[model samples]
Target: MENTRVLWLYIILLCHYHWFFEEIDGLVNLALKKPAIQSSTFLNLTASLATDGLIGTRSTKNECSHTGVYHRNPNPWWEVDLGGVHTINRVSVLNRAYFAERLRDINITVISQDKTVTTECAFYQGSVAAAAWATVTCHPGTSGRFVRIQIYNEAYRDVLTLCEVVVEGLSPCDAFYFRKHPGQRLNSQLVEEIQSNKPMDCGKACFLTTMCFAYNYNSDTSACQLLKIGDPCDTTVSDPGWDFYSNCLN
Candidate 1:
């Protein structure tokens, strides 16, 4: 009976771990955590309130400020540079145009030195707004050295304005940026000092706090990260924060 109990416990723990990892791709909410992904060369990137002019609005007045470019053909598409090697987990994209058609497909793939694989991360089977936000969950697979996102439907009626694109699972260190300041405000909670004797405190805090979405535990500096979760507006991942802290603080 003890052995059976242990097996059951293991299964439960595994499920719980997967459950905690969510794949939400909509307007962006506290529930979804920002991915830690970087390209091997160019590095993953983003746009901002100042750069785009506003949040939650289709800014036709201005184009994407990041390396992302707007195209006249097949609507519009922006290619993000996911630096380094990684296995993709989840993806989210926004274009916000309906007349462009209901939409069709969302594809996530990777290209390496010798081989290329296309793993269907997420998909929508019809027409969608030119400014529509689409999110896809890719199958959890092995290591992918290079990653790319391709969305398709109607051809170039309008430029596919990509508002946000994100993928989590495995991306190298170059694709992300983690800026840590213990005294700063993340959403609302002020990071006190690095809490010692309780390293997993971040994970524990996530379980207790409703506003809290994700967290990082700095074992060396004894620091904890409490992020202000938002809808893809300012997506931040706390775990990668801990990775940096590991080397920096120690």
Candidate 2:
């Protein structure tokens, strides 16, 4: 029951009202939330997205110098440039790399044009991957600008298969992810036809149809809701979706 509750929590985080959506493998979108005051971001590792579709693969950069990969990828280290957000409290990263995964020898640093700080936090709490939905929070002792999530060493691969990367508790800049719609429509006739008959798995419906950015599921009434999730990053990752998008049909 606890596990189910956590899963639901994760699904809720994936909703549009409070998240920033990014398209990866196209199987399902890589869903996540902006840094909240006290909440964590939802990430998935069971998927990956390229130009073609979704696949279960990691990043590997061959023929390189110190810019290497434990598993090797076209590049190493997936960094989300927090841009210019000054006040940030914590970072929640979901590790779903499965049993054969490990994020060893990692470094969590706070970087800035003027001020910077670094820590050997790779030994903070987790290993390379999170078997379940694990939470990584920051403490008062850990804070800075240019928040760099670097992989200095890895027990496994430098190419990490991350589902979502959320910077919680936004202090200045505006950043978020989530969907509150059924899907993107072109015509009123097409839209009306959909509102008449909804899907059984509304949460998972949108992603499968390739129309939805995010979705909303009412727990109590006929108030069906969904929305479009916006993108915050340029690079895409392929991971599976736990949330569904509903589609109504004639």
Best by TM-score: 1
Measured by C-alpha RMSD in angstroms, how accurate is candidate 1? Answer: 17.7
- lDDT: worst 10-residue window of model 1: 23-32
Q: How would you encode candidate 1's per-residue C-alpha lDDT over 26-45 as one tens digit per residue?
A: 11121122222221111133
Error of 1 at 95 (Å): 2.5
Q: Candidate 2 lDDT, tens digit per residue, 155-230?
A: 4444544444444543331223222232232211111112312333343344444545444443333222344434
| CA deviation > 4 Å runs, candidate 1 | 1-56, 63-77, 97-104, 113-119, 128-132, 155-159, 170-250
Task: Report lDDT per candidate.
Answer: 0.41, 0.36
**TM-scores of the candidates in the order shown:** 0.41, 0.36
